[model samples]
Target: MHFDGSTWWMFYDGTSRGRRHVGLATSADGRSFTRHPRNPLVLDAGAVDVQRVGGVWVMLRESGTGTLWSTSPDGLCWVDRGRLFGLSGASTDRFGQVTPHLQVVDGVPSAIWFGGASVVSWNRNRIAVAYPDGAPAPAGSGCTACVSAGLSCAAACQSALGATGGACGMPGSTDGSRCCACAPEGCERCIGASADCHAACVSAGAAGGWCATPGSTDGSRCCACW
Candidate 1:
């Protein structure tokens, strides 16, 4: 029901064709759709468009398997960027689709998604949302810590288990100047500081102060964030 970059168009997918694909129809007006010569522009094939990058155009499809993206110049042919993100490496859930709801936030393309836990999101060329194993904390402000922990996080502050000095603030914020980690006093929270927070830690793989696990923190500790 959304318009193509120019003309009006309708998009549908993943049910009738026995494959995941995008069906397109043109309209002289915003209503009254007419199937275009190039109907079903995209098909189910394991590419970003087929089941990644969200509802064929929105930018937030979460298959629970992982987040993937497909790049295209004309919404015609697409290439797989491959697992743009996931909840946890140990995850096995598959909501069966990645709906990338891309939007410009402060003049930048940011993808919006809805699915399982550990689904983190960041903005740049486009907002990248994902988790590791399709576990908890997939979306929401906590994503920063969840993704930093490679999606194994159950809310850093909450995980502190109420220890006097263990728990911290919530996730989200702090990137490209965006805020991330919630202040220790439970005051302010970061909006896009997923990476910097990890980078500021003593080391990426350490068990103290913001570090999550190996391969998730620094290249020396965690996998070093893809």
Candidate 2:
């Protein structure tokens, strides 16, 4: 809820006909809100969060598929702005992404979202933050190995892994700035700096393995053959 002098604006998730959408309401006393003539301003999206930036009102909503945003001049009208990159492309747990919120850290706008693993949090409920200004923002903070790396997740993974004498037999998944190599069913999946999928396989005793599918959420289920 935010106040614009005379009217108080409230943005919330409103349901109608078994669908969740973003809605806006106005109140003069911060209570007793009157829904806008056009309720359910947003359709087919969840995890809606609203904020005003540079005199423009922006709304963010994310799900397993991806994260997206919209802009509004008033609080009621909106213009959808495609998917939210960066964190949106990151790994998603079984339930997609959840609890998306916004915060300003060190004067930078960031989005926070959560996702769970193993049907439950399983200590893997992802509570990660994404910065619109690229990750590791403010730059030049120790990790310069990727200063001029390629933009694709696979390229980044290959460059970093190759530099460490590691080779990936296939593509990898991206999480923020780091790339993780997910090998086939009989290989070890590793997510860390300069770790290649093939290297991880050999390290885990599964030699000459194939890379797993991109954005694969399958855990380390190695095959029974040494």
TM-scores, one per candidate: 0.42, 0.52
Q: Pick the candidate with the highest lDDT.
A: 2
The lDDT for every candidate, in the order shown, is 0.40, 0.54
Please give, for residues 132-224, the per-residue lDDT of candidate 2 as tens digits: 556553433222233333233333343444332222223332233443442222233343331335434446665333445534435353322
* Per-candidate total of colliding backbone pairs: 64, 2
Q: What is the C-alpha local distance difference test score of candidate 1?
A: 0.40
Error of 1 at 25 (Å): 1.6
Task: Name model 2 segments beyond 4 Å from true.
Answer: 86-95, 105-108, 111-124, 134-226
Weakest 10 consecutive residues of candidate 1 by summed lDDT: 118-127
Tens digits of per-residue lDDT, candidate 1, 176-224, equal 1222232232211321343333323323343223323522423344322
